[model samples]
Target: MSDLKNDIPDFQTIMLPMLKLLQDGRQWTLNEVMRALTAHFNLTEEHLKIQVPSKQMGLFRNRVGWTRSYLKKAGLIQYPDRGVYQITEEGKQFLANNPPKLRMKQLEQFPKYKEWRQTFNSGNTKEKQATRTEEQTPEEVLASTVEELRNELATELLDKLKENSFQYFEKFVIQLLQRMGYGEFREDSTQHTGQAGDQGIDGIISQDRLGLENVYIQAKRFSNNSVGSPEIRNFIGSLALQGVNKGVFLTTSRFSSSAIQTALDSKQQKIVLIDGKELTELAIEFNLGVQIADTIDIKKIDLDYFEE
Candidate 1:
């Protein structure tokens, strides 16, 4: 049910045991290695059932597969036949050293493995080059890569947002709030009123169809400077004129600490602040200005049928 958790070992952690299993110089099938390692690690049914993000392969099974690939690349093992592998003489010699752990750093020291890494370099990454400390499951690597990409996308989106007109920012605020499941029950529940003399209000959202309660919105498209306490006081004063106690102040820069304190100190009024970074994050999360690019699916063999 879970996908790639910390409880499961990475590909590197399984390297030593995988090599030791073949110490007898006997050929082993992939299924045999999996079964042996399953018991060897004392992995439970729940552990066995745990999958990668794609739900195509078991998390532990994927790690074992990568471990086998790395060992083969390092010349520590060989595939004599389809789905059947055995320890090589070089592997036996390496094992004779009885290294505490067979990590990527150890594998890169081998001439053939180092050459293979240079040719393919799938195993080596900027992360591995920097840390080279611990092995991460492919899922873990993918998650980190995805996070980095999102951060980059958020930065690009924020820059473009600042370039747009204040009217666009006002519309973006109303549309984003609607996309986030606000004012969805009624038509025209969210409105943009950013034109001449809009009384410090950029937009408004009706809580219900009858408009018994409303949330005032003030969107500021600042390129550099932060919103100060004076701006916040004016916005609060604008809300006071409307006899409203709820408001959202959004900006393309940031809020001054004093401005934040002002909002917190507003006794009867509730004001939520959204800065540039948070605004971009919400824009990306609610799919305001982004599109899905690709999806990956990892597959696994039907080990139960093979066991039978």
Candidate 2:
């Protein structure tokens, strides 16, 4: 089994076989493709159990997922329905040519895939070529992929957030702060002050159960208009009315340069400004509104282990 680990095929090596399996022209479920490929590859149970670095998924299965994605992108195979895989006529024709192996170089021959990949690189280079090049280690490729996924997720989250009501935005900020360990000691430590909110303050979180220490929040669900200096100054004034220091100003749009300057220039108060991008990122990091759909771990030979 340990020896088989070294022999396990990389995603590129798995791609051709996966496409062939799909070329039967009948829709196959993902599990069916996975099982057929497992037998085709002669992978052992231990091979199936071998984990990527994150250990959230089996290494061979992880490679297979990548293989499926690449083949689909190359116009070879597709998901006609959720979890149902089928090869396109183009894939069948390509299989008849009996390409020895499917790799990024081969996929680049398809105009759809080449054009699709350019969107990721956005003129820097192709996505696969940039990430999976000989110049990059496997870990580097994984990191680049994670970064791309994170950026896309952030954009999606922000869009969804903007679709909700202003009232929801107020409660959302409170929930996010609570998840960040801001009000861990009490069940009611966080509250959406809403109408009862002090001045323009939208909500409050008691840093302590006794409410001796508190953090204030002002949420702006602006769509097109950026939060300007007047908004920040008003939030600052609200803090003054409450006679306390710390506050967070969260917005769904962006902060104007003057708005940012106002927050920075607040001498007596501590002000933190969270714009759309950072707000979504924070929500993701704290697992406030997203789930871990999948994970892949990267690994390498450890020179230090041999030394040890």
Candidate number with greatest TM-score: 2
lDDT (Cα atoms) of all candidates against the true structure: 0.82, 0.81
Stretches of candidate 1 above 4 Å error? 1-135, 299-308
The lDDT of model 1 is: 0.82
Q: Runs in model 2 with CA error above 4 Å?
A: 1-134, 196-198, 301-308
In candidate 2, what residue range of length 10 has the lowest lDDT sum? 118-127
lDDT of 1 by residue, 1-308 (tens): 33436668777889999999999999999889999998888788888888876788888988898788778767789877778889999999998988888888788788657644443334434336346335667767667666645655665577568768988988998888988878983558988888899999999999888888899999999976889999999999999999999999999888899999999999878999998878888998899988876586768898898885
Model 1 / residue 262 / CA error / Å: 0.9
lDDT tens digits by residue: candidate 2, 1-308: 56878878888888888888877799999889889999998988888999886778899988887787667657788767777889998898898988887787788798657644543332222345455567888677666667766765675576567778889988998999888899883678987887753589899999987899999999999865789999999999999989999999998878889999999999989999998878988999999889998755547799988995
- Model 2, TM vs. native: 0.57
* Reference-based TM-score of each model: 0.56, 0.57
